[model samples]
Target: MSGFLEIRRGRAPLIVAFPHTGTDMPADVEMRFVSGWLARKDADWWIDDLYRFARELDATCIRTRISRSVIDVNRDPWGRSLYPGQATTELCPTTTFDGEPLYTGDGPDNAEIDRRRATYFDPYHAAIGAELGRLRAVHHRVVLYDAHSIRSRIPRLFDGELPQFSVGTNDRAACSGALADRIGELCGRSGHSHVVDGRFRGGWTTRHYGRPDDGIHAVQMELAQRGYMDEPADPSPDNWPTPIHAAPAIAPVLSDILSTCIAFAKGKE
Candidate 1:
């Protein structure tokens, strides 16, 4: 696709969005990284593969092939800190989840951050915003699921390990009570451990666009990489890799969660 972002159409009221699954960067930008490859580690590798069966559910799937490290699409474009006091990645991060320096002497300055945001972030969100507007116009209500994943444990960011599913509705502010309840219930039935509005209370995209009062609902699912990938405690050049075969162990449950959300959106419509 010529556009940095890719949007696929489905008549369903649900949009399965992958906001952190890219690994591509412009050549000039790639050279800025400490070692090019480290920059790609933050991507939600192979997320589309997890939703390989999304089309079967008639979902409107939207994805990006650019790595989040290049420019986090989930973050606030204004550059305001999402967690305030707590540690979190920046609009242009200087380190990985483990706090490993991604750039050498200096990272992207304010100007570079703005440049990347203009080149990729804004365009990506524009597509997301347009698609959500389209979906809601058609259904009168639309559900946006911001999909993401991270290694199970990252001491620099959080203590211990992350749960398999960390569902965030911005403390229930970004979506309807009905939407959250239905998705949470489905997660329980699917037998996968989950926490609602816990460590991750949603990101900028979820909080900014999920205007249920205006008939738009948004949710974010932060999956522990262990759930679907061969994650490592400390990543290296080769030892750890992603794209683990999707097994029935977690597949049916994920489908149930997504299916329930889809049905919930249609119900609202």
Candidate 2:
């Protein structure tokens, strides 16, 4: 229970991980950024709020308070690109999704990057592993839902507008194909465009922790921000993030997605 980590224990065989919802940046870290807003722009904006209902399902929820700009907990610790030859942020990113530099001058050196990993990244994943171990002890099978969201259009990262729901199971290696199909089916019924194993086929968190044969099923849900937020073509402070209440139309879909995960964990899917 470090200052950077938040965990809610539950008896259910489900763990909902919020890896990028954090916006906090230590003063020293924030000082190096070009702008406060830009540093926080690419965060999984309001994702924690979008999935706030996870608590009601008696699902274990773990999140981080430190911004991903400091160190991306979802990235590979050893510096291997999740998508080789593709543009993606590093474990300790120095730029925004739009290719804007986040630092004033020089970014953290290799030594500093290692320190950030030890200080922040390690504990966050530790908490996740701890929660999973605790739940797997009681349940015959457990599900790890690595929740995330992004702007619908990031030309630097993808071709065009992303699907409303981008579900990933590391190409059926992270979890059972049945679980992924069930979730994709629900997304299709929600009337929202979706793709399985699309551009974001899950990040390091999904790849590292997922071991379906060991009874630990991991899946990553990368939602397009437009599905739940008022995404202006050019977002500024005034209109960048629409309030959570404004996304009522999509709440039922998110709720159904999570419920489906729980049902799958309990072998009811």
Candidate 3:
């Protein structure tokens, strides 16, 4: 409940974070953008809604209503690339995932980028840390599940269609090997395409707070938008952001995934 950042506390030893589902754009910030539509195009559209079942598991949920177009909370504030040589956006991105310019004029300068990081990015992570501390005090182990979604095809970012389930543990540096293996086993039986440590291997949040030795097991689940919603091939303002209609089969799978996360945190193994 800190400005645009929202945190719902739960007794369960699990936390779900939505870093990119936000669409709120401040007037001053929007004025500098090429178009609001384009700025929001790459958002993890309706992702928070897709994972509504998290609440039923009594899992804490943390989210930011401030759009990623404003400042990607999941990215490293120090400006280091999470993927190093891969195609990705910055902490304060100047363009969309498709390499399209996002601002009418030159994007935010270094000073402005730093300001955004302080005003928006810092608080988001702070909230996450606070929740983790609270949950960890009660349980020996806690799970931080970073939820994200992207278009099935973004040629600029990856080759061919992205897998439906893109689980990332920073090559298993973020979470315990047992946790990673459990998630991998679930995805393998999901009847959907999946890859581990592929094009995406978790972002800064996953890499930073994930300390298995300290009992914080973090994992990032990046879903292909096509799995839960209609993703038009050529997305325009008119045909973009197809409504979220979780496929009948996909709904149960998502439930099971979160449930498994809860079980894992409870040491159910």
Candidate 4:
């Protein structure tokens, strides 16, 4: 088992990835942070629990245990902005989403960034690529569902409260048109606010590995944190990550989404 990542193997033609759910901050890295709370504030909180049901579909799951504060596994290793011209975090962010500084000093320099990338970034993608290869070997098609979540309101990054479900296919270039449409339809019927190919149209993982022609269909599901948990207008260390509802409001819709993903990979949708 790689200490950096956790991988659960399955035979199904589906892979569920949780890139921002990690909160592990190595001692050396933690020392540079302004505070542990700010360092972990932007993490996709409780995402591991939110999507735990993916295990039931026998979907291969890959999750990084290293906090995004150390290195964002879903980001481009070369430091290219996923959402160009928009305010977003970096491969190794030095600030919180609210634009608060996270580092005591000048944060990670180029040398430190490179070191973190080699230590954390590479292995995460290797695991993902390895899983994709394994699944593709057994099945003609495989679906990589990159799961994530964020607070509903972050004006610095977005204009208004984000939709309950932000489904992204990198402008439909990552996955099949039919698959995108299916997810849109389900979200539309779920009675929750949702948008497709909006502000967030997937990330480096989706765009890099999503080769439909190669039998790999990738999609990113960015759920607004409000849908499943209470999102304070102004979050603090204590009240930020409210417990995920015993029964989240978006549970059934999420189930349908994953089920459809499996069906699409199996050519049943």
Candidate 5:
């Protein structure tokens, strides 16, 4: 019933959550974004389509339809940096991923950011937590797959290019060693470039909800946008449009990853 967030219940113990696939910009907030200020360019395009296997596998899913430009559901509410010393966006981003300013003049200040958190960020996280509780109540163990994607060659975010599959578990603290090792080995065997706890060592979602001791495990999968799409040279309104579709070639790779995750959770359960 909530437009800000959506949770699809599944029978499987695994949950596939897409926190960055949202593109909706509230009316009041939309005007705040100056025309061609690059707010829409930085969206995590078609991440939900990448994880369509969730529904097929009967995997629970918690997603937010609200744009990250409104409030990053993956960020820490305490304002802690997910990646320190790195140029990362905040709860309410001030610019696009390509370092383009989003507002001509002053945008939302401290008070506004806090209000958005209460309205969007807090509810989004609460949905995740509630879904985890729901799944755990049915299954012995529940695994959360925090899904995200970004442009592969964003020099502002990282040098060179991002690997196809970027896995993170907060340096193996978020889940059992066995689970992490299994996923890592599976990813490597799939012939895709995969890294464990590399630049994306999970986010607030994985760090906060991952409690192996409590029968809840969390892991983040950051994929390069190139893995699923032909990223435009410039991701903007004129160039990159809405309903960003995922390429068919990447389906098997992602489905394989999700299947592996489900197997791992079943094993743990």
Candidate 6:
């Protein structure tokens, strides 16, 4: 266990990847940021807690403690845009989702970016790959559920209000259609707004690891923060996060979605 990564092993053939729930920014790294809170504003806030029940299902949980502001593990390390011609952050983001500059001076140089990749990014993916190998050896198939969450409304990122659930399998190339459909169906049954392969069609983690032919399926679930937390129209330090509480109305639905993922991995669904 390194200072930046954490892995909880489970006996099931499912691994939940939490790449952006971290808030830690190394002291030297923080000194370069414009605002500490803004650097973390776009994080998948409390998603780890939101999916705390993953352990009960015996699903392995792999997470990073280093803030995404330092290095986004979900992005392509080669610097290819995930969404071509669209506005998005890079592997080492220079700005927040809102387009605010994160660094006081020029952002990370090429050397610094390389260092971050070696120190933080590489290990995170290594852990995921290692876990996948371990699980695939024991189970006929394995599922990689990349968990994430964002504000309900980010005009800079998407138009108007976003759906409560944004499911992505890299446009159906990352996982089997059956698995994707079942998860979408469960979300629909929850009566929450949802879209498959919508604005967020997975990320580097999903696209890089998912290989249906290899018996490894990957899917990304991007949840709207409003679905689980109190998101004020205008956020302030006092009420910005609103704490991490299980939204009485949404917890059961999320559980059902995760349960479906485990079932898919076990081929019981």
Give lDDT tens digits, candidate 3, residues 1-269: 13798888899999999999999988999999999999999999988898888998899999999889999999989899888788999999899999999999999999989989988998899989999999999999999999999999999999999989999999999999988888888888988888888888999989999999999999999999988888888999999988888454566777888888888888898
Which candidate, 1 or 6, would have the higher TM-score against the true structure? Answer: 6
The CA root-mean-square deviation of candidate 5, after full C-alpha superposition on the true structure, stands at 2.1
* lDDT of candidates 1 onward, in order: 0.82, 0.89, 0.90, 0.91, 0.81, 0.91
lDDT per residue as tens, model 5, 1-269 = 24777888888888888888887888888887876336667777788876777799999888888888878888998678989999898889888877777776787888998989998888888888888888788777788989988888888888988888888999988987788887787778877788999989999999998999998888998887776677776666666744445455656777876787777777731
lDDT of 3 at 205: 89
TM-score: model 6 vs. ground truth:
0.97
lDDT by residue for model 1 over 140-201, one digit each (tens)?
77888888888888887888888788899998899998778877877777666788998899
For model 5, name the residue pairs that clash.
none
Q: Clashing pairs in model 6? A: none
Instruction: State every prediction's TM-score relative to the real structure.
Output: 0.95, 0.97, 0.97, 0.98, 0.93, 0.97
Residue 52's lDDT in candidate 5: 77
Q: Output candidate 4 Cα RMSD.
A: 1.2
Scanning candidate 3 in windows of ten residues, the lowest lDDT window is: 246-255
Cα lDDT tens digits, model 6, 1-269, are 25778899999989999999998988899989988888888889988998889999899999999899999999999889999989999899999888889999999989999999999999999999999999999998899999999999888888999999999999999999999999888889988899999999999999999999999999999999988788999776667777876455777887887788778888898
**Once model 3 is optimally superposed onto the true structure by TM-score, how far is the C-alpha of residue 82 displaced, in angstroms?**
0.8
Winner on TM-score between 1 and 4 is 4
User: How many collisions per candidate?
Assistant: 3, 0, 0, 0, 0, 0
Question: Candidate 5: TM-score?
Answer: 0.93
Clash total of candidate 3? 0
Tell me the lDDT of model 1 at 54: 76
Per-residue C-alpha lDDT of model 2 across residues 1-269, encoded as one tens digit per residue: 14988899988898999999898888888999998888888999888888888999899999998899989999999889999999999899999998889999999999989999999999989998899999988887899999999999989999989999999899999999999998999899988899999898999999999999999999999988887777889877677766655655677887887888888888898
